[model samples]
Target: MRKRALDTVFALAQQDERVVYIGSDVGQGTLQGFQESIPERFFVEAISEAYVIGMAAGMAMTGFVPYVNTIATFLTRRCLDQIAVDLCIGNHPVRLVANGGGLVYAPLGPTHEAIEDIALMRCLPNMTVLVPCDAEEMERAVRASLDWSGPIYIRIARGGESVVSLPERGFFIGKAIEVRQGEKLLIATTGVMLQTALEVQDIMARAGYNLGIVHFHTVKPLDTAWLANQLGPYSHVASLEEHSVIGGLGSALAEWLCENGDHKLKRFGIPDRFADRFGNQAKLLSYFGLDAASIAKELQAWVKPS
Candidate 1:
């Protein structure tokens, strides 16, 4: 997914001279290609995340579309004031490419976890939050962001994600993509958890539980009308994400459903408490009941015949 995003941005820079890439001490081998291709446009801010945003904002002020890549926590949590005021309030064409979203860097402890990034960024007036489900979606998002005129947040999983294989034209900012068709339950997922929802849908199908999957890749300015229509028939609905249950996708969906009178929903995500244990991504996901087995168990208990 990271490679796809980098390659897409590099390709966009080839055609649009307005595009630039800036990093906050990010010298990964994956970024080497962009540095080689557009050395004049790529920059390293030497660990100053706030300066990175300031520089990106300065570039945007001069009509350059700057894309800043960094760890999720540092990019948003550390430099939030710059993001909210400099980029968002200014409505600059600065694309925030944040990797390791939603505890993908769980092994590094809470400091590295970005469980509330979406909620934090979504509060800004002009910020557009995008959580691509896979590499293909990330590529599409990159292409779209090149021409986008305002600030945008692109949250990507760490690495090693399956190909979503959706058409380029099919990707839209305010539309939800229906991945599967089922009868009893609707699975609304964002980020890499959308893949998990697909796996769970297959498992539930074999177990005779019909499930519908809706990939809500865009968290901000959610596609509520589309979601409400799809969720109208299901007796039970599930909202899933890799972020916190508070003010994240679960809360967004719940608020939308309540405002629209769509109820009987289940929320699956990280709890409010800080995760004290240090472990790998899979372990952390399992510990939070975000693993497929645990999610299935929870759904069975909640959706049992009543």
Candidate 2:
């Protein structure tokens, strides 16, 4: 997804001179083709995330659409002030293309993990938060966001995520897509967890229970009207995300449910505390009960009472 977004940025810059790429100490050869093709518009500055954001804001002020790229934690946890004051407050058309969202860097530890990035970005006004599930969807989101006003926080995994998103659903910035239908349980998720949710859907189907899948690539500015309609048919709901349970998709749905309806909501995500041990992303997901089998077990246990 990260590769596709940057590639799309280059593709967009080809037609529109306003589109530019900015990065803060990313890996070698990250966008070499982009830099070679458009040397003036491309930038791979020093490892200063905050400074990069401030610079991007200045560039945006001058009518240049800067797509700022960096590690997710550095972009959000380290550069929140610049992002809020420079971009969100000014309503700049900057795209914060974050890498290593969630536990993609589990091998690197908690400091690198971006479990609270959604909580940080969504709280800011004039910031459009997006977490596209696949490479195809990343292209769609990046292309669609060109004309949109204000800053956009696009959280993406390292690379090679499952290609689960469909073009037939018709991607939108602030809308939810109902990917699959079910009878009783509804799994509302975001990011790469859509693949886990889809697997859990099939698992439950094999167990003689039908579960639906709804993908929310756009976390903030959530499709509330669409969500309200979806909850009526299912007896229970599960919000699966690669973020914290405190202020992610679960919290967003909980806020809507507070004043609107009386529905059962089960939030499937990382606990409030940081990770203690680590391996690969799959290991961490299993530890958090976010894998397909663990999620299936949770669904069975969560729905057995009703």
Candidate 3:
């Protein structure tokens, strides 16, 4: 997804001279390509995310569209004042292309993990929070952010993901995309968990249980009307993500449904515990019961009445 986003920024920069790519002294691999392509427009700051955001805001003041890239934790957590005051409050057209969203850096420990980025960014006024499910969606998100008037926060995983079905054969901002149809349960997911959701859908279908999958590419400004119509009838709902349950995708959905619509819902993601051991991505996800088998089991158990 980062690679696709870099390509997207490059393409957008080429077409519109006003587009600029800013970096906060990170992401060497992807930044190399952007520098090689558009050296004049790309700028890398020295170890200061706050300054990077301030600089981007300064550029935006001159009508330049700057897409800042860095790890999610540092980009949002470390420099929120700059982000909130300089960009979001001013409604600047600065795009924040954040990577390592959720626990992607689980082996690197909790400090690097960006579990609360979504909630933090969503709380800021005039900020658009987005977490694309795959590379294609990432590309679409980049294009969508270009036309956006205010600051945009795009949370993405470290690597590529499988392509899921779109909403009725298309994509739209501030709208929920339904991936699959099921009768037994509904799983609404964001980030890389869409892969696990699809796999769970297949396994449940084989077991004669139908399910519905809603891929929510847009986290903030959630499509409550669409969710109300789609999830209104379902008796059971499971919101999944790769981040902490505190203020991520699941929490966002649960809050929306709790206030505006009436529904029974549960969240499935990394539990409210920091990982004590270092391991690969697959092992970390499995440790948190985010794997397909665990999710399927949870869903099947939910189907059984207490």
Tens-place lDDT digits, model 2, residues 73-146? 99999999999999999899999999999999999999999999999999999999999899999999999888
Q: After superposition, how far is residue 203 of candidate 3 from its true place, in Å?
A: 1.9
Error of 3 at 62 (Å): 1.7
**Over all chains combined, what TM-score does candidate 3 have?**
0.94
- Per-residue error for 35 in candidate 3, Å, reads 2.7
Worst 10 residues of 2 by lDDT: 297-306
What is the lDDT ranking, best to worst? 2, 1, 3
Residue 101, model 3: Cα distance from true site in angstroms: 0.8
Q: Report the Cα lDDT for residue 161, model 1.
A: 79
Clashes of each: 0, 0, 3
Q: Which whole-number lDDT from 0 to 100 does residue 288 have in model 3? A: 87
Better of 1 and 3 by TM-score: 1
- Number of the top lDDT candidate: 2
Candidate lDDT (C-alpha), each:
0.86, 0.90, 0.84
